[model samples]
Target chain A: MGQTTAEKIFAAHLRDEPFPGTKVIDIDRVLCHEITTPVAIADLEARGKDRVFDNTKIKAVIDHVTPAKDSKTALQAKMLRDWAHRHDIKDFFDVGRNGVCHAIFPEKGYIRPGFTVIMGDSHTCTHGAFGAFAAGIGTTDLEVGMLKGVCAFREPKTIRINLNGKLPAGVYAKDAILFVIGQIGVNGATDRVIEFHGSVVEAMSMESRMTLCNMAIEAGGTSGICQPDAVTVDYLWPFISGEFASKKAALTEYGKWCADADAAYEKVLDFDMSQIGPQVTYGYKPDCVKPVAEMVGTPVDQVYIGSCTNGRLEDLRIAAKILKGKKIVDSVRGIVSPATPQVFQDALKEGIIDIFMQAGFCVTNPTCGACLGMSNGVLSDGEVCASTTNRNFAGRMGKGGMVHLMSPATAAATALAGSIALAKP
Target chain B: MKKIFGGPVLCLDRSDINTDEIIPAKYLTEVTKEALKPYILEDLSLDGFDAKGAPLKNAQVIVTRGNFGCGSSREHAPWVFEVNNIHTIIAESYARIFRQNMFNCGMLAIELPKAQIDTLVDMAKGGALVVSVDLPAQRISATADGREESFSFELSPFDKALVEAGGWVEFADARY
Candidate 1:
């Protein structure tokens, strides 16, 4: 039988020889955020477990409700900070230290090829861009992972997505993935390992690939990964302070790195990126997507470009290039949040932040603000906003507010026209 | 696991019933799990669904066509159902994380074909439907209109054990 990518990762981590149904494999890294950490700790304490099993391997970040949204969220963040401190966990990232769990880990080199990672946040699958076997778990499941430094999962089937040809002008990785979801529907890739191949994925930047893998959850995919290439190597070089050879060696040693020629997939999806367009969701779900031309001139109240999904440096660069020296229309409220502290600093050094500010945009700190409707920039009743975030579920930005999901370029264009507009550059 | 006789399998009969439809993101920050009860199904566009807040009142079983829980892997979707007296859910299929969330919370989710679900919904329409889910036997039997019908499903041994032990946390409590 042809082993899937998940099986290969599991086989490598298993204590015994791997013929997998379920095994409590060793976890290399585990991630928790403020919302989940409190619940996990409360569960652990109730069960008489006083400490995390492996504090060094665990990282806690306070991003979602960071800068403390309310008194309750503030208390939870403080509790997590104190607990992480008590554990002497060196990787613990407080509000200012870490930006977003998914983005910052890769920025700091915590996620690399061949590693098995699990985070309390579903977007943890974002690390799959680096060939990491990452998945999301519930608060209680996180407790189990913390208790034993491992968690068991049913080996999943694999789905191969081949992206051939080149994307059209103004189209991006976000549009491609959104096109995949639109065709397959939300649950089309349910519980499967979605592996990307062919020329289009090969051409995407590490940041763009992260955007693609991050939304695999939107299509009910467990993990979405692409084979590492020169782009990945280049991205990791700065993180490792320069380890080109070692990174290549580690990835190669993680045998069964790619699917075999004869490997069988439960489903195979092919996309000619030429057919894709600058995409945006019309309604609540991420799969409710349409092209920019179709959605043009749909009025918007606010436009946000950030999140673990599309808040990286490249995303800001593209949006900034379009919005340079042009003031955001008087009606639209433009906001951009760079994904990580590194991305924020890089954007600042590159004058991207200044361009955004000059366009009358609010360039905020690296927090998942207003993405999940918890913190600042929240929408009011019956308001609609253009967002670069992943999920646009009902009441995502605020109570009775609607979100239209789009890429940073489209979002910037929306700021210019005060409606759903496509990027021209 | 104990045999559960779930009252009136409320046929939502929709595809892609996402977590947001179950509970929106606004109420996600509210304290206490019980606070979700009023907000449950508050955003779904179901016919006759009261937007002012109409929860699944006495319905113990929720039957859907396919993809019962799709977008967003919020475990609270299942947790909210478990808290609001939802014991068993019969669906044609479920998204990955949502199904696992259901099992971990001991809110039983069983897969039945849309054809079988159509039959079950038809039977439900005939009169009051009493759906009995046998966790160990992996069978769901429905009694309605003075007739009884049963269908078989499958569950992994580990998930069955979790169901038998009530929930994952409880199972963890016993073992660890």
Candidate 2:
């Protein structure tokens, strides 16, 4: 029988096709971060599972708490490192090489195209950039994936997001995504694969494409996918050069990466970028976004310009320009976190870090820190903080804290005003 | 294993009520099942939330709109309902990830009709009302002032077994 792109991918990965509707596909990649794995390992040890099914296939990275910054947090990071070394996990990116779990794994080639990826972190959907089917699993599920290469899953419906026209100046990929979330609301794509196509997406850089797929989980999609185009081939060819060469030699491969034109989808959403503007999430949710011009001076208690979502070099450049020669409002605690140590170094080389520090922004090391309220940057009771992270549920950054998600530019501007401020030209 | 369904539900029609909203993310640090009770629905009170807020109060089941749990993989999402006396949550739809998480933890997430959602919302705005859900009948009978409406849902054998087992822990315990 003919099948959709989703069915084709599933069938290729199916180890035990339990039934027509419910199939158990072999997981291609498994990712675990410091926070979730420690307890999970403890649970496994309790369960008497002495050895993992395959350590090479497992990638554990330390990212949640880093640069230690304090004695307690330093101990946490050390514990995670010790566990990784003890387990013989092949890919362990410590503090220096560590980054947000989703960003680091794909960059390292642990997540490949047309493969099934599962991670303990919720944003595992970020790997869908390479046309992979990735999803977040709980600790129990992670335990299962570690013990066995396959994970039981019910196939989800696919959603086609067609994009056309070039993005307007100042309206970056993050805004386009926030605009999509606003239209669809948070749960619009529940249990579905979101495929981006048409001209606009074709024009995006690989880094920007990663940004787009990274936020798919914000609107509750199972994963976000962009087909393997030239950008994908170029970005992946570096790390997987040998694998790509060998795979190319064999024309007929079981797991080919391409989206069929007539692939079935539960819904199709069209986004015209010419009409979009720089978006800032107003109240709390990612979908609660409006153009930056309309959101300035809304009053905020904090401004955070970082997270896996927008802590890249380009994001810092934008933020630094807004913050240069200016001071963060006394009431607001301004924070800047580079996505990786390399990003931090690059920002320093570009004088972006100097600009940020001069503006009274506290610079944090690469980790999913303040984004999840784990470390020092957490918000206080009823405090409204503008952040560049994905989620904005109440107290996401701390107890009773209010998080307003926004672009890095907007966050920097908000830092200057001690409120939600638009990035003025 | 104990049976948790076949009880009356108190419907909440809010959509996209995220994990943080269900039981503020801070409470998730507790590492124990019993600690989840205090934070459930902490965001819903007419008075702005105090950390000491009681969950679900005297509620049984909750009925809500589409995409009820849409963000974060914090286990607190389902633990909120289980600890707060919410036996089943009937929504028009639910977030895929949250639904799977809830299912794994032994929660009965039933999808019901949207018309009843409006009625439930109206009743909630006025005060409290009773919603009866019968898993065996595959119908939810919503009751208020001599009026009873029945809504239908599709259930798999796995879910039926889960409902019969009361929840995930009990089901696992029974199996082991």
Q: What TM-score number comes out for model 2?
A: 0.86
Shares of reference contacts reproduced by the candidates, in order, are: 0.43, 0.35
lDDT of 2 by residue, A1-425 (tens): 34445666787887764345555677878787765555556655666764566788888877876766565456556655776788787688886888877766776667666788888667888777777888877655575677776665677678889877888766677888888888887766777788888788888876677778878888888788877666676666666666645535322242356666666777888877788778877666778878877876778887887777887887889889888999988998888888877788888999999999999999988888888887758877878888888887766898678787777877888888887777775
Per-residue lDDT for A163-215 in model 1, tens only? 99998878888888888888887877888888888899988999899999999
Interface RMSD of each: 3.0, 3.9
Name the regions of candidate 1 deviating beyond 4 angstroms.
Answer: A15-20, A239-251, A254-256, B1-5, B30-32, B51-55, B145-147, B170-176
The TM-scores, one per candidate, come to: 0.93, 0.86
List DockQ for all candidates: 0.46, 0.33
- Compute the lDDT of residue A197 as modeled in candidate 2: 82
lDDT of 2 by residue, B1-176 (tens): 24265455555556777766787654544444566777676665234434352324666777788878777766557766777667678787887766766666666788766776887666555545677666677877766656666677887665565556553333443332
Stretches of model 2 off by over 4 angstroms after superposition: A1-5, A67-86, A94-97, A246-255, A321-332, A416-425, B1-3, B6-8, B45-57, B83-85, B118-137, B140-150, B161-176
